[model samples]
Target: MRHLSTVDLKVEQVSGVTIVHFPQEVDAVNAAAIRERVLRLLNNGVTEMLLDLTGTRFLDSAGVHIIVRAHGRSTALRVPLSAAIPEEGTVRRVFELTGLSRLVPTTIGLPRSAGPAASRSCSTARARGRGRKPRR
Candidate 1:
């Protein structure tokens, strides 16, 4: 296993949607890390993004800033930003309280299963955590 300070970030591309799976916590300590990853994807010409917050146990102002910045970048690139939030969780509450849902398209519940014909790419970070080779 890696160090505890390392946040697990997974990105899977399916049907033009890049799913970003966040770790247990997204705060000031790790917000920059997450921002860099997201910006990298955007720079790589990803036109759609889905932020999966099901595993996110907590989020702070920095976390929210990351999301907002991602949203702005997506808008600038004409990419759509969506969110997959848990039905009941602190992350969900934060999004609601901050009106993030209104700013971006969000689906509450499990991530929708990927379909065939969608090119899938799993992030190296998450694959490392699972001790599996990353797929692209």
Candidate 2:
């Protein structure tokens, strides 16, 4: 993580993709700033983005707005944006309840130690919302 916590966010750049991870709850206090940072990244030649919400514990309309705007702007600019919200968590529920979940493209985040099998499992889940339950 690139620890950009001055605004309660972190950024990591890997394989030409910029990952902006939120480490704190997003609310009215930092929503606009977050939006600004994202826009700045987009304008400053960062094309690919991943909004990682795995660390986020709370959210509000402002938080959703930041994402909605990013999604819209990225779409207009033809840039790709993906989200990494846990398969099951409070943040996930907030996104679900507010309908943000449906709007954003998602990929499950897993620890580095999870290896290839874990990654494969998550990869499947991301393609069509949560993966199907195993049949009895």
RMSD of each: 12.3, 5.3
Clashes of each: 0, 0
Error of 2 at 12 (Å): 1.7
lDDT of each residue in 65-134, candidate 2, tens digit only: 9899999988888898877776567777777676665677665563333212132223433444455576
TM-score of 2: 0.75
Largest TM-score belongs to which candidate? 1
The local distance difference test score of model 1 is: 0.74
Worst lDDT 10-window in candidate 2: 112-121
- Where does model 1 exceed 4 Å of error? 1-6, 114-136
Cα lDDT for residue 120, candidate 2: 22
User: What is each predicted model's overall lDDT from 0 to 1?
Assistant: 0.74, 0.71
In model 1, the number of clashes is 0
With candidate 1 superimposed using the best TM-score fit, by how many Å does residue 111's alpha carbon deviate from the native?
Answer: 4.2
Give candidate 2's error at residue 38 in angstroms. 0.8
Candidate 2 residue pairs that clash: none
